[model samples]
Target: MLDQTDHDDNEPSAPIDMLEAYYAAHNWEFERHDDEIVASIKGSWTTYELRALWRDDDSVLQFLAFPDIKATDDRRPALYEAIGLVNEQLWIGHFELWSSSGILLYRHAALVDGEEEPMLSLSGAELLVESAIEECERFYPVFQFVLWGGKSPREALAAALVETHGEA
Candidate 1:
């Protein structure tokens, strides 16, 4: 097992570039990379897990797992819930990857909050749902698709906006 606490001095591969190479056939672009996590290519969506021990090298790692068409429904709602907290002091999240059989396998832990009690906490289903919703928003009208239970990117993001701003 790899030591989670070990921080390799090597630079972690840029998630954007890695994702781009993996989905070269689709409309791809780098979105964000903070800390050890990165996201890119809003369209032609596929998730990737590091294939080998990156050891903090110059931004190129292999990851085999991708999005599963089956987990879209059961997981989207939880994802939506997580996105709602993005602006809150308690919100922290990552991309939830799953197998084609609908079983969740991995997640890319990206966001985090440093509050005393940490306001945001999400169920497994919620994480999957949020990741899918995130893709829809980034990919938009060009790559129209929904992965969550009944919430599409349009609905989930809109609701998040409303819930966040509306409550204020």
Candidate 2:
């Protein structure tokens, strides 16, 4: 029965508490499993499974977004190259491919320490989820171009870098 109103101003909000409040306010559907909150979000190009968890010590908040795409053996090299290229330009979080399952995930972490608890906001949690989705939207086409379109790694990345401008 702990709702948003249950949070006391005098007490520091735990990471999961903040996340629940934020997600509930935004009307996003998620399941709380143990220490993790799992949600399915639809991006521009695909749907992603997003998970948020707090460390056992409650010092770190971790967010991970996994897309539906999986790299095959023949596509692994190009995907790796593209991941490295995309990661270099990112300010927060990084893309990683699990070798065993070829699963690609975007990972980000927010560190909570000292007096920073008072400063945490809902926007911060939203930013973490949004950033992961944005990264996936921005770079997923490169994987598609390389794997399905049979383009070289360089060409695929180049294609993805082409930005479209609309009339303002």
Candidate 3:
């Protein structure tokens, strides 16, 4: 059994180790190198690149999910508006467009601090990752519609947010 209280000098490896355990438990194939866990999870609309980095200095685990695509310059304005509207409805995390890459992604950070010992747990990791996946699955089409469908932000969002009852 791995010791949960083994936070030595705020080493970054501890969080990654915990995440390794979490991935194993969920049967997820992931690559661990340095302070990051890299995995690709397939969603309803696309495949997401899950990049989780352990920030040793800040004691934060930043989890990012990229949707395997990037925004073009012409679509930037509409994409930005859609992101704002989507972000307003998100309760846990928000979406961001990396300036240099123009890649869209979901961002969430979890503070790894334990009162008695390290608070890092598999359940916590699962919660954060699952939440990102859920949000990504729900809103992915809004990006696609605006970026590729030649639709306005409002139109794209409305089409994506429409509720369908029961299985078709």
Q: Give the Cα lDDT of each candidate.
A: 0.34, 0.78, 0.81
lDDT by residue (1-168, candidate 1, tens digit) is 122222232223234333333223233333333322233432345543322112233322222223333445656455444434332322333333343454332233333222332122222212433454454344332112344435555564455454333543
Q: Name the lDDT of candidate 2.
A: 0.78
**Best candidate (score: lDDT):** 3
Over 4 Å off in model 3, which ranges? 1-13
For model 3, residues 122-150, the per-residue Cα lDDT tens digits are 55666788899899998999999999898
lDDT pick, better of 1 and 3: 3
Would you estimate the TM-scores of all the predictions? 0.21, 0.84, 0.87
Among residues 3 or more apart in sequence or in different chains, the pairs in candidate 3 whose N, CA or C atoms overlap within 3 Å are none
Per-residue lDDT of model 2, residues 55-164, tens digit only: 85757888899988899998899889888887887999999999999988999988866464523455566677778888888888987897789988789888989878
Q: Once superposed on the true structure, which residue ranges of model 1 sit more than 4 Å away at CA?
A: 1-94, 104-106, 109-149, 163-168
- Show the lowest summed lDDT stretch of 10 residues, model 2: 1-10
User: What is residue 95's positional error in candidate 1, in angstroms?
Assistant: 1.3
Candidate 2 residue pairs that clash: none
